[model samples]
Target: MYARISSDVEGSGLEVTRQLEDCRKLANSLGWSVAEEYVDNDMSAYSGKRRPAYERMLADLRDGERDAVIVYHVDRLTRRPIELEQFLEALDAAKVRQVRFVVGDTDLSTGDGLMVVRILAAMAANESATKSRRVKRKMEQNAAASLPHGGYVRAFSYAEDKVTVIESEAVVIRQFAERFLAGESLRSLAAWLEDNEVATVAGKPWRTTTLRAVLASGRIAGLREHQGVIVGPAVWPAIISEEQHRRIRALMQQKAVSGRRAPRRYALSGLLRCGKCGHPLYSAARQTTRRYVCVSGPDHGGCGRLTVVAAPVEELIAKAVLYRLDTSELADALAGRTAQDEALAEVTEQLAGDRAQLEELATAYADRAITMRANG
Candidate 1:
């Protein structure tokens, strides 16, 4: 007996149970002794997903372990025409052609019955395709309306409704954004989240990839994204400002282009260049002694003619840095940096005002309060 239900949304397995009962009754009435039953609940035949029980039944049929097959319906046996053909081939190889269906009373013993099964399978496949198209269209419409996509778990900083911001998680999200923008590495931020007992929506420990995704998502900036494109503002309130989100994205792109590396083991790892070729010297070790050497190869593109003892060079650079920090020129540079910081703050505020004005113009145009030309 082979019983399968395409979808068991409630996961009750009642449909599969009902199918097996009907199939068993049909087999008993036909006076056919059943050796075993194959059941595939919550599995779809048209989706091309693996159905373990169905495959086992086919294996048994081909091995001649089963002389006959019984199912609740033809569609239950298979919705795909190709799979129906494979089933027939399996029966032919075993030289056992007895097959029965409780609902459609389909029999593989006759040529007409085979044709009917093929037609039913084709119809089922068409119906599945239509349903898939309808569902995808609905989802696209929902995305255009800035509605939340369906998911089992809520978004990181949002509630189950997907619109309401969870204050606690939102706070953490802001902290993540701020720290990341301040030049903290994703790995460091992930460790901070783990150390602070902050778990993801799925109750899993923080990872760099997961942290990077949340930081880069437009959802936190009150934007609706569909198929990896930001369509418009989302229904939910923004966690951090759009400006911060844009900066995070830009920084992430820059990091991706340049490629990030693990923390430097030595202070002067990449700071010193070769005197001969001016190429960056890589840190290397010989026995217990560490040194910086210019490597020659397609990979390094260096002259490989210069080498420096790591200890002396590192110590000299450290002393120089410390001495330079106490100089009047350094004091003057610090003062200049303070002024630059203030100027940057003013520019940032002005940019925010401009962004707000642009948003108002967009809103006016959308609401038909102003013409597109006037909004522009």
Candidate 2:
């Protein structure tokens, strides 16, 4: 006996149980002794996802271990035409001709019964296709209206409704955005999240890929994204300003283009230069002691004659930096930098507005609401 239910939203196996009971009654009435039963709960035949129990039943049929098959319905066995054909081929190869359905009672021992099964499988496939189209259209409609897309878990920094901001998570998101913009690596940020016991929506520890996705998402900036493209403003409030989000995206792109490596392990790794060749010194360890040496090779293009002990150089540089931090000149320079940051923020906001306008025009063109020349 083979029983399968495509969906069980409540995670209850009642449908499969009912199917097996009907199949068992049919087998008893037909005077056929059942050796075993195969059940696939919440598995879709048309979805192309693996059904373990169904595959096991097919393996038994192919090996000639089973002389017959019984199911509640043809659709329960398979909704895909290709799968139905495969099943038929397996039965023929194994010489197991007896196939019974409790509801349809389609006898597979004759040619007419086989034809009927083929037609039914094709009809099921068509129905599945129609349902998929309807679902896609509904999703598109929801996206256009800036409605929250349904999912198993709520988005980070948002409540179960997907519109209300969770202030605690929002604060963490803001911290991530700010630190990321300040040149903190994604790996570093992930470590911080883990150390602080901040878990994801799935209650898993943070990873660089997951951190990148959260930081780069438009949802945190009050934007609705559909199929990876930002459609428009979202229904939810922004956790970080749109300008900050745009800057984060730009910085991420810059890093990707440069192919920058992870955070440096040594303080003076890239700071010191070779006095002989005027090239940067690469950090190397001599036995247990750390040192900076100029590399000699086609790749490095350095003279390789200069080498310095890392500890003393790093200590001197740290003292120098600390001294500079207290100087009046450094404070004056920082005041100037504050003004520059505000100007940069203004430019970033303007750039975001222009990009939004371009997106609107492109959307209008795609919808046939404007001419190509006007869009340009």
Candidate 3:
């Protein structure tokens, strides 16, 4: 007998045990020996979740381990019409002459029985769809009211109410934003969080993927998102400023673009820009020689192809970096800072700050307070 319930059936008083008892009684009356039973507890068949017991039972029937299948009801077996068709096919292939039910004795081996089963399955599927639509409508209404999702937000960074930020986690969130915007790599940040004994909302150590998700989230910036798209501003206070969020997004996009390009096989892939076409030069190795090539041809973008040996380019870059580290005053201050802070500074230097910074710089340049020669 196959008996399944999608929830705490005993607590809900669904009587799965009673269903099994009835099936056994029915088997006794028919003069058939009761075989093994299949049960799936707290598993929704209509939700399309895997029902291991149901699958195993089907396999057993196909392998001739069982000649007959019994269930409490047809809906208990399946709510999907497509699955009902599959079962019919499997039953025919297995040549199972009988399908018994506790509540009803239907000879399922006939064409008329199959049609009746299909119609029952269709009705079950319709009921499931109607339930799903109602649930979705309720959720939509809740979202429109800016209510906490699913009646409980339970986010790490936010209070149970969802609108109020938890100060401790909120502080960590701001630090995450600042560190990321400053240029700390996701993997490095994840490792640092682990080293500092910072646990995720689930009380697990941080991962690069998880850290990236947090950084990418607009919820920290007081924005509401539905299905991955930002719907509007959220009711909660933003942990990070809008400028910080914008800078983080831009940085993420830049990283994504670089990631989409070929993996850097050599060290000097990003240090050079094409003098001729202004495209970033990439490292390409040919036999023993690693060369930096500006691939901005007609095939790539459009540019005058520029190529240079990697050895000299790398040497120049190394010397410049070493010189800055050894001689620059800023480098001395960086040495005093944490690895995370140093990394952030590097990113800030690359990005030259946010849009407001650029606008301010432009204004200063126009006012002659910052000369183009000095700034460059």
Candidate 4:
């Protein structure tokens, strides 16, 4: 069986392991060999691009690699209509059968089988499209009312394991912004926090990951992000003002360009451009000071609307493009998933302790060797 569980199920019950188990059992019961498995991690079902595993699997079916392709569910294969059709056509051309959870043991190679499979695929596609429309409508409502639907805001505890606001974490985030706006470099902030022995949101000495995370966050500015889009009207109290949030974002934009270090520092150099003329808008420092400018109209003098303030635009861009990968449990069986994940928390705890002990022993041996060398 050519089995696939989209990246949405990476850590969930539909993980490759679970899907393999179910498919292996089903295939074995039917006296068939589970020849291969294909997995697409961190790839969204909504998009047709960048899914190598999905494409390869379709090609394999076309080349007669397997008599049937099995999945934990239909949506695990695809949610996009065009891509799904491409898959079905590949199957039809090859005259290969397919199986999914809903169609437990049915064959899809024969004419009758093909009709049933088509109906089910259509139903799955319709349901997926309907759900997609519903989600888009909800987000539109969010945008209209200025609510957070796209993961724009992140409280210290809110986005991580702790979904609720912890007062201490909020305080830490507020101080992070305060230090950021006071013209402290992220490196300096990290160093000072470490020297003074200040803890991060995760309660340890400062590091770049922990520092930049706070500075880039909009939670301090009373906004929230859902699925990479900015949403406001958070359920928790905010740590900083929307205006302060804008300033921090501006500072990030400035620092991203004008800092005196290695020279080639441009993120949106080739990606973003005028939606009208399709020219590029490069990121560069402002004056001798640190700031970036969007040079859309200067190239051709088309419209003045191409200019965006360095900071806020960068912040929005950062939130939008960075990672944007939350394929959250779309392939996992939602009904029985929570219990499986909850059971693994204890193992994570044990692994963390082992990691800490190993670090301490390594640190001690290095310190002892350095002292010996110095004394000698």
Candidate 2 per-residue lDDT, tens place, 1-376, comes to 9988874111122368667876787799889999999988645545578888889999999988999999866667875767888999999999997898764456687644565465445434444434443468789998998887875788889999999999999999998899999999887788777778888999977766567778888989999887566789989899999899889888876765464432223444444678988886877888888899998643245798999998788667656655654676434332323224556435334433433332332232222211111111
**Where does candidate 1 stray beyond 4 Å?**
8-14, 42-44, 135-376
Model 1 agreement with the true structure over 216-244: per-residue lDDT tens digits:
88899998887456789989999999999
Residue pairs whose backbone atoms clash in candidate 2:
none
lDDT of 1: 0.67
**Candidate with best lDDT:** 2
Worst 10 residues of 1 by lDDT: 367-376
Candidate 1 global TM-score: 0.35
Estimated TM-score per prediction?
0.35, 0.35, 0.35, 0.32
Residue 40's lDDT within candidate 3 is: 83
Task: Judge candidate 4 against the unseen true structure and give its global Cα lDDT, from 0 to 1.
Answer: 0.51
Better structure of 2 and 3 per lDDT: 2
The 10-residue segment with the lowest total lDDT in model 3: 367-376
